[model samples]
Structures are given as structure tokens and as C-alpha cells.
Target: MPSNVRHLTSAHGDASFEACVVPYLDAAYNLARWLAHDDADAQDVVQESMLRAFRYFHSFHGGDARVWLLAIVRNTFYSLRAKTASDAAHETIDEETHVLVDEQPSPEARALISVDIEALQTALENLPHPLREAIVLRELEECSYKEIAAITGQKIGTVMSRLARARERLKTELSHCSTEACRHDVR
Candidate 1:
């Protein structure tokens, strides 16, 4: 093997990078899923992001691995968008790809849940990328404003403004849901 070849373990026999990244795979997938809006595309985004993170592991000083990896996920998604607009434009989330907590709800109950999920996802999808990112980071991932700003390379004020606008847009778009979950979520 060439000296420059990267492996799962570091040169000094440390697996710190891998260790740091493994726990956040689901978080990475969730972000990618939200941004790409399609299962296959989200998988691609996460794979590329993981590769990039490994390739750049040496450059990472000590910090929150989740934040660092998520930033990479965001960049990978945007790069894909820039390179192939049409590939992304037509893609939508495939219901079969996601794991449901319910083992097998009744057909009618499943339909209702699907409708609720779709409404929420569509509202999020309708948001502009910046606003969507803000909302996802803050609301879903529960990141603080400072952390979002750090990951996004934006001023804290910009992050706050985006979150505010995203929330309002989601509230208006989700007005029809009126369900307890939606009500509890959009505030």
C-alpha cells in the first residue's frame, strides 16, 4: 500500500476518527435525507460525505464530530445540486426506504400517519435551502444557534433570522394539519 493511502485506522494506530464518526451516521443520514429528499440520493450524499471526512480527517482539530460531519454533508448535497439540477429536481422521498417505529399499523392508521408525515415533509421541502437547513438543524437536530452558525459558516444573526423565517413559513404551510403533533412541533 502507498504511504498516502487512507485507512479506517490512522497512521499512529488510532481509530479516533472512525470512532467519532460512527455514532453520528444516523444523524448524517437524516440530514442528507432532508436535504436530498430522496433515499438513494441521501445515501449517496452520506457516502460521499463520509469519504470526504475520512480524506480530511488529518485536518480536523478537536471539536464536535457531528457538527463537522454535518457541514460536510451539507456541502456534498449542494455540490450534487449544482452539478445535476435535473437529477435532484424530480426526486422525492420513497416511503418504503424509511424505517417506521410502528411494526405494522392498520391500513387506515398507516394512511393517516403517512398523510401527516407527507404534510410535514412537504412544508419542509418547500422552504428555501437556507431556511430548511436552519429549521432542520435547530428543530430536528436540536442544535444551538451558535452551533448552526458554526456549521453553516454564517453569522449568528443570520442563523437566528433564518430560523425565525423558517418557523413562520412552516407554520403557514402546515396550518391544515392542525394535529397535536404538528401543533406541538411548529412552535
Candidate 2:
């Protein structure tokens, strides 16, 4: 056990805030990063959310801790955004310029892969905030529709509709990019 792990007496509950909440840090950060669109802003959101989660940990009953933490994260991000609405409008989300690569490819190997990471990212960023979140929660975060609904405070049907629209929009955008690329190749 790490020295930092806090153990509530078995009487209170076996679930440590560290055990349940820490496991979702990456997922929390990922969602925050996408929502906040800036690394520093995302870090702030996660930090505040963690604090809020710790404060309310005793209230959490046995259930999906990830979704619980994410709901806090999402709410924190929105609150932060609301406070900085004027400034946020002027600042571009870093996701537009940075690609999150899960795997490192050698320069030679990278040349062989023709995927336009920037285009995909731009398309994702262009989506309405709600639709963008739905896609990220479903596709990138791999949350089920029900979990997404809970985290987002949307009906399951709304989650499904947002996802459907998001996918269609992405497909249309990417297809348009492909068509433009082919036209350039022909010329």
C-alpha cells in the first residue's frame, strides 16, 4: 500500500477515495482536456474536481465511481468555463494543434501512415459542444450510453441521438477532406 492511501475504518467503508477515484484520473483528465481544450485549464478542472470528490466521498455509495468522478469533472469544467466565458472564446483549444498519439512511430513508419490527424481533430473541435462531448464520451472514453447519460445528465435517448449526429458529422467532414485530397492528387 502506498503511504498516501487513506483507509477509512472498515466500519465506514472499504472503498478508499484513492482506490475508487484515483483509478479514474486518466479518464477524468482525458474528458477534462477535451472539454477544457487547454492542458493547464484541464489540469485545473481535474484538481478542483478531485477536491470536490474528496469532500463528498462519504456520500458515494457502491456504484460506478468513474461516472461519479466524471460528473464532478464535467460540472467543474462547465463552472470554470462559465466564469471565463469571455477569455475562453478568444483562446483556441490546444486539441486543435496537438495530436494525442497513443503509440510512438518511428519517423520512417510515420511516413507510411497517411491519416490526417489534424483534419480529424479540427472536425471534432468544430462540432457543437454537446455533440462533441457525446462523441468523446462514447468513442474516446469508451463509456456506455447509460454511463454517458448519467455523467452528462442527459436522457439515454438524447445520448444516442447526439452520438448518431456526431458520427454522421465526422464522416461527412472526413469524407469531404478525402475528396479534396483526391482532387489535389488529380491536378
Which ranges in model 1 have alpha carbons more than 4 Å from their true place?
A: 1-14, 85-87, 98-100, 103-111, 177-187
Per-residue lDDT tens digits of candidate 2, residues 69-179? 999999998898888756453236464346445468886555434256767877887888899899998999999999999999999999999999999999999899988
The best candidate in terms of TM-score: 2
Total backbone collisions, model 2: 0
Model 1 agreement with the true structure over 1-187: per-residue lDDT tens digits: 1113234335545578768875687888888888887776777888888778887988999899999989998999999888885754534657666426585799879877877787887789889889998899898998899889988899999999999999999998777566655667645
lDDT accuracy of residue 85 in candidate 2? 52
Pairs of residues clashing in candidate 1: none
- Write down the lDDT of every candidate, Cα atoms only: 0.79, 0.80
